[model samples]
Target: MRIAELGRRTGVPVPTIKYYLREGLLPPGERTSPNQARYGEEHVRRLRLVRAMVDVGGLSIAAVGEVFAALADQDQEERGLVRALSTVEVAVTPVPEHEDAEAAAQARAFLERQGWRSDEDEPALRALVGVLGTAREVGHDRFWELLDGYARLCGPLAEADLDYATDGPGGWLEREEALERVVVGTVLGDAALAAVRRLARKQAARRRFGNPRADCGTEGSAEGGSEGPAADGATAERP
Candidate 1:
């Protein structure tokens, strides 16, 4: 297909596709003539991946280039690809040098206590510390106190994620696809999980209070009598 057809098929504009081609984000199509080229299905697949990284994954062009390079490197083993994808995904913003040393130390300690194999200097670690520091400054120190519970919840999820990624019926994913999946999953899965959590929270609230409206705060009057939208509103809002 020509570039125009490629753009139509991918729903990307022609100029934008040219920009990606110029930026080294998309490989050049085969030169059928001096000014015309034909792109194959591989180009279509790559363009979709590029769009996902930029539009959904929120990666900068340079970071996407790095991720693609890592994915294409034949020498990188599975573990290396996973690490490289994660590093690029999480290290989009540089860690501030002035981040609180105490928070950094605490973050490192927490990781150590959890027996996770993360480096103290990792950008993700620094990012955690920065958030923790901000939480303390905002008088939300109890947020950090909830780390253990959050970790416990994450433990099973992480294990399940790895199990799915590495134990497919045909065996683990191919290196390139695995790397792409990791990046895409990390980016999109957060939104998916947040939606799931909200539904779960609504269900739990309904079970605990015997009425979802009662947990919405408006129905929880000082008299302790539930008064709000009756079954109709409840059914309308039910997940």
Candidate 2:
């Protein structure tokens, strides 16, 4: 297919595809003549991946390039999924500014209590430390009380995530395709999980503390209930 056809098939504009080509996000199509090139299904798939990284994952061009570079670094035969994922995750996750040392210790201690082994430099761990530090700074120390429950709940979520990534819509995929699915899953999954949690919280709150006089079809009202705790705890934020 020509560039125009590739664009039509992928729903990305030709000019934007050219931009991605220049930015090294998309590989150049095979040169067929002085002014024309031919693209294949691989280019189509790559363009879709690029769009997902930009639109859903909210990655910058540089970050997408870094993720591509990380994917390229994986050995084709060995297909180091873990290493590729780690590199991609590091590329996408913002490095939090160093904050409370005690918060960092507490985050690590929480991981230890959960029997989770991870390097101190892990992006998620650092993010947790940052969040904990921020909470402490804002006088939300009570938020720490729910940390264990969050971890416990997240364990099943991780397993389910892996299951969905591996057994995708088309069933088992090749290593490269599977890696792509994992990338999209990890990025978009966080958003889906967060939104679902909010919905669940609304439902749970309605069941537990909603005003009895309020119409069932309407939004739950906590008119007669005590003020809910902050930082996403139910008794505080739900989960």
Q: Report the number of the highest-lDDT candidate.
A: 2
Which runs in model 2 stand beyond 4 Å of their true positions? 76-79, 168-172, 211-239
Cα lDDT tens digits, model 2, 87-183, are 6678678768876898888888898899999888889888888889899999998777789999989998887776665674346667787678678
lDDT of each residue in 204-235, candidate 1, tens digit only: 86678665334455443332344444654554
Q: How much is 121 displaced in model 2, in angstroms?
A: 1.2
Model 1 per-residue lDDT at 235: 45
Q: Please give each candidate's TM-score.
A: 0.79, 0.82
What would the TM-score be for candidate 1 when compared with the true structure? 0.79
Q: Candidate 2 lDDT (Cα, whole model)? A: 0.79
Model 1 spans with C-alpha error above 4 angstroms: 91-97, 167-170, 209-239
Q: Report clashes for each candidate as comma-separated counts.
A: 0, 6
